[model samples]
Target chain A: MAANNEFVGGKVMTTLYQHGTLALLVPGLFTGTQTVGELLKHGDTGIGTLEGLDGELIIMDGIVYQVNAMGQVRVVNADETVPFANVHKAHPQPKIAVEDASSDALKQIALKELKTENLFAAIRVDGEFSQMHTRAVLPQTKPYPTLAATAEGQHEFNATNIKGTIIGYFSPVIYAGAVAAGFHLHFLSEDHVMGGHILDFDLAKGNLQIETFDNFNLHLPVHDPDFLETKINAKQAMRDIAKAEN
Target chain B: MAANNEFVGGKVMTTLYQHGTLALLVPGLFTGTQTVGELLKHGDTGIGTLEGLDGELIIMDGIVYQVNAMGQVRVVNADETVPFANVHKAHPQPKIAVEDASSDALKQIALKELKTENLFAAIRVDGEFSQMHTRAVLPQTKPYPTLAATAEGQHEFNATNIKGTIIGYFSPVIYAGAVAAGFHLHFLSEDHVMGGHILDFDLAKGNLQIETFDNFNLHLPVHDPDFLETKINAKQAMRDIAKAEN
Candidate 1:
């Protein structure tokens, strides 16, 4: 779904929310044909943004929903366009678990599994989270500010007793702009009532599912006239992604 | 200008080929509006394939050309579509020059200047070469085979007394599917008589111009039905790219 989403080429598959390379949804450039229904055909799980970055998109178990600007999560229109997303079929590993672990500590365990930075991986954290902090960017209009600027206006949320799965991608630093250099994740409650890119969390009891992808395939938005004409500055974008995603 | 050719924030800049994520040219996908002229707007140098995999696309000093399957070089039509290309503005580093240098030795020098592999870089080696070997992929059509399969039919060339620039990119391992994990170079003779994706070469003497990209931006071809439907196997594609480009 994003950079390092591949392992030289392997059997595991993973998708991501818009990688930094394809991040920053261009305003007025929506109306895409890649819908949730279409995306589901490719993978059963992933994250992305609705057309115009209208809200956060969370695709889990083939169903799609949007976390609107009001922090309300609801099933989305199947025909709605998805300008950017990262997803993959779910493949949970039952061997890893933690009853009480901070997000930072859990990430260390995941890193141990990584072994090397070159591989692309998908992570799933399921169970109850005693505490979690998340954020989502409100959609923008034409002349959209850089993703970093939009991130500055992110809506923050704090939740407790949240039962859901945290989904994300682990990219290498080399892919900084192509995708997030490191982990880029989003959240979805079991009830589909809460979701957005995750910032921090504490799991009272959670199990981790890790799937590694050896190879990656990325399809870009070429037909969009604005995408064709834009003069992109990647350095700043990487900075913005880091500031916002982390 | 592909995915990394971003207008998103008009700020994020990145350089990746249609290298190895959204690298390959899919079948039944053509009539791209992102022309050689359009690519030139972003940078003056790069390497890619023309629409329908017509030929090798080499853009040097702002002019784009195709090295056909027959090994004949000619200026490409500005309107010609480029399905996949890797390009960036020229950055001539006079201090990085070597006389009577083999391509292998020269690469070491460039690596030293790199200092870090985290950034995307465009490398230009301009000078005389005692011997050079290059190859190009013929344009393709609908029901296109995987790039690895297409590589089996690649056309190769060997040359001496060649002078001009070798244009290409250096991506990190994590971006293997998105860009070449290492050096991916293309040759364009100063006389505009020959060029192709690099295979091997002996540079009698050459000057190295390495431009570091702080960020990367890319656009995926989403409208292509195949892009949306195909189950990408990045592992095999990377292998194929290695077989063809290296």
Candidate 2:
């Protein structure tokens, strides 16, 4: 059943479809078994990392894009693979106008207005940002390093006075290891030239759309041998991966 | 998509469909929002608890049965609601012959033979048992007490030289709060005369069938105001509810 099906009465349910776990990636299990094309079938809006943990992934309007470590943006091929991702079918929700909201401010607004503390919330913001901080990791070769180590060499940049859409998900603390515990957001500019894993941002003025999901579909990888053999220490990974706090 | 759809090749995917979270029940929220009829639509077999913490629920062969505090067996009404449940469509798997195995041994075999430590595992055993220990709680009226407090008054019994089926699920440690971290099982007699939440068992020889799932569907209830307002402390519940450990 879709996300809305979890509730009674006539309502549009949106399932938060996720492929792979952040825990697997923490231990350097970067090889992907699910392709981009297959992931798009589950949702139109989402965020994740590409195969090899090459770059940040942004899915908007059913199109997949990759933001490289050098802050380069490119449309990823449909056949390209992904190591981890979270996606959902976007249903139209009433947009609330937000002014000069910080990252934490947005979280508070969602909790106070949408009442999404216990549930998973899908958020989208379309407007100009006063400042945006983001980072992306380089593609690794065979014998991939742990995500924490990979993140150490990430390319961080600042984009000011830019128009973009914020795509993100808020996971409950219970899913800390399986996914990032809190807000994990990514940004994509209108020009499709700037986008990456968002570190921080100041929304000048934006129309914030929030959708709460009552269902979560965690799709794990079966083909990857590392995923099977690895004793995932996600709690350890969560402690080590500081960037996961985004 | 079905559980098998998560994998690339043609392997029957078994999706572990769960309604409500173990965390929600921690704070004494025993109101059933999802009906038994609604739960069975997602899967044919499962285990759960009834509203008001009435009894242990066992779903086998598409039939729902409740074992009360007195260890009495009765068919649950289709409209009867459950506070928590885990179910999956059973795709026939090669059964492994297990002989004179304890509860821990069954887990070991599942790990060695089925390799289910990292994945969600659905296990079923049909055979005779030398010793079977189980417990069930009485139905609580409104103004329900917390699960830990209700578990204190549980009725425990021992059944020796009995034939029954063990229905259970193994959740990874990452899901400790949402579901039991380890094996959570329920037992039902072949004659449908005896059944309850399993504490321990000694199987003489049985056909142990295990289905590993790559997908986990966590369906949350939206109608329950308690679920929305309550700050669920599942970690606290996990520490207090000793019966959660099988």
Candidate 3:
């Protein structure tokens, strides 16, 4: 199995490609510099947000989709820019049936099934959801406020008896500032009518697929003065991220 | 200046390629899987150690050199394995001159000159040192001890009026567990006769060259059981790293 993919010492080495830090996003460094076109070059599946906290983004099957504050889903333009994202090449992994599980239960399942508690893993869940609760922030103009502030004004969307896919990445506690520690997930309904940053969900029945990542390619925004000039306090930023993301 | 290298929004982005995490090292996970030949494919210059924490490694001008526990420097073979390393392609950058400066003084100059307090940067210093203090650990067998314990048995070497180069990296506080926060440097004499992990140094005169990195490619060893099964405690590992490296 290791020899099937890119191998290093006969071990499959899958990379989780990340753009911009969650710490940068907490302080509202929302200027989009990397285009959706450029991001696809690295990997095909992931999640993130557009510039100015425009919407919740889902990259599936090499296509970019955005779920806006008004609960409208649209196929994002190739030239559209993204402020932050986590993408990776998808591969076949063992699957497990998850029934009547909450968000926390899903995390526990990941920990037990994947054995990636200390390492990074990319997770995907596909099936029917009894309840899905999500939110998306309205696009902001120049001089954006902190993400926590933006999240407070975010619009919530709820759906019941819906079929969709959940995409997210699991980061270890040590990488809290660079990426959100633990499961950070986003949802996209099957019909492309409902999707956003997932706040909570009750999985009625879903097949959980997970791939462990051995490499992390962290790309920073060095050109943006806002990124370089801002004094990012890791501890404070982690707190802000927890508030906003949760 | 940004246009001279790979540009994203008019900013030059150089990358630092790292194999294995410092946290893995503190716990004494010292099985070398990545070969030196394979590592050089990512960058030309860097610092790290051989398998089993055998010695201090200094990579310069695309050559891999290892300073043994007895302070003997020798060119490493292409197939020699590396347990941990940090490497990047050398690029031209503005230079600064330092005379009569300590290790702390060198760090201050880097912070002032590079303006990379929140970002990662690669630093190099070449010149004569009035005094140099360094150490290297002997090779360990199976069931290696913790790095802090190994540091106790490390062989320390000191020299005066020597010409050498300092190679190191500056990682932000947020990345303390992944990489050591602040400056982590290693020394190699101009004659390639005396070099090791730097404990302290007094520079008589040296020209400093610094390059800011916008990307960090961290590769982990997935096949090694020590890497996969070990439960790494970030906080404890950090304390141990400080004791060993300092």
Candidate 4:
């Protein structure tokens, strides 16, 4: 019974998408377009990828899955193409609790329930998982090397008591190397057949949802003639996207 | 004709807005409402204020000035009321000149043309200011005395050889105790009669414009039943809003 005037004059319409920048996908510049049916006609949830880089994406509630490349997950056709994403549209709040921590101690208890670390949070933890280590990447074409050489070789998965729901984001270490500098999660399994992204887990309890993003809008592809004629070499592409998107 | 397919699929539908959180406007929750004529519907530009903490706002291009507290500057009034702000919406890019610089060297040359700093940018420059330093507060009620003690009195103003267009925002330092962590400007000269907020300026050349937001939406007033039952005491309200909203 408390959402505080649900954002009176402080405004809060929530809409996020960074698209391309890790200094332009580590200089590889992988193309993009097939926008996920216009981000599911106004988001319902998020996580991203697809479009040639074929694989790993999760959009819960509004349906839109795709894990591909051997590790197989599925759901996405009608020609889904979105290259990178980070959707949002669930403004519900109030749902806390859980047990075992881990995953950097749930990012220091969601950084003390996000007092500050430079805002941007959308963590959802739904339950059941004594173990979980996911990964999913495999799809790149036309000379694309960075993204730590296309995430070197990802295809790891482990699940124990699984039900699932991680879908996350914290983003702030000045966007470390461009994204995932602070936190980034992605997982799905409510029988939608396993998931990807997330790299660690434990969560003893379940049902945790946190949302905090305070106004930010950045959309740039500059009509892409190589997105401003690529040249990005920012310190070895922020050290290969801080060791492959952290 | 190179908008680079405007983010083809990399997706970039930015929209940032973190309305309330300096631990709930430092215990003094100065009531809010008029929502800046509804954030000028799709934003024309920004910088915030108005509710109780009367004066000093700047909406530029989409119109909405203020600056009260003695310094008097007018314009806003479509039922204005906003409490805090940070608008955007103008993806036209390509305008650079800026000279003499200062203001953290134009934020380190706009952080190297903003490659990344955890996204959120709208900096416009325009130009022709030989000098400028502004402020403008003076409007609070309900025993409110935080905000670095009502910004310990503010009303400074200075201008000379001016034309105008400062409306700024950079935000990222975990929203410096909830907003205005990194950069936050607000000047409007050009015939709209001097403005406020910006605390310094010297631009030499003109035309600077830069936009980037990548999504972020945080609007929480929760129907202000004391806004989620106020309780924020986070290190003296984040050292009094990181020393008065950065």
Choose the strongest candidate by lDDT.
3
Highest DockQ: give the candidate number.
2
User: Which residue segments of model 3 deviate by more than 4 Å?
Assistant: A1-12, B1-13
How do the candidates rank by TM-score, highest first?
2, 3, 1, 4
Q: In angstroms, how far off is B111's CA in candidate 4? A: 21
Per-candidate TM equals 0.54, 0.95, 0.92, 0.34
Comparison by lDDT, 3 against 4, better one: 3
- What lDDT tens digits, residue by residue, belong to model 3 across residues A1-246? 112126645755688989888888887899996889988877889999999989999989999999999999999998989889989888877878999998889889988886655678889999999999999989988889988889888999999999999998888767778888889899999999999999999999999999988788888877788888887787789799888888
DockQ of each: 0.05, 0.47, 0.39, 0.06
Sorted into a CAPRI-style docking class, model 2 comes out as acceptable
Instruction: Return whichever of 2 and 4 wins on TM-score.
Output: 2
TM-score of chain A of each: 0.86, 0.94, 0.95, 0.34
lDDT at position B86, candidate 2: 89
lDDT of 3 by residue, B1-246 (tens): 112125546755687888988888887898997999988887888999999998999999999899999999999999999889999988877778899999888889888886757778988999999999999889888898888888888999999999999998888877777888888889999999999999999999999999888788787787787787788786788788777777
> Which residue runs of candidate 4 sit more than 4 Å off their true CA positions?
A1-46, A50-53, A58-66, A69-82, A85-193, A196-246, B1-46, B50-53, B58-66, B69-82, B85-193, B196-246
Candidate 4 chain A: worst-modelled 10 consecutive residues by lDDT: A1-10
> Relative to the unseen true structure, what is the C-alpha lDDT of residue A187 in candidate 3, on a scale of 0 to 100?
95
Q: Per-residue alpha-carbon lDDT of model 4 for B70-115, expressed as tens digits?
A: 8878888767677567666666789878788876788788878976
After superposition, the stretches of candidate 1 with alpha carbons farther than 4 Å from their true spots are A1-20, A23-33, B1-246
- Stretches of model 2 off by over 4 angstroms after superposition: A1-9, A241-243, B1-11, B241-243
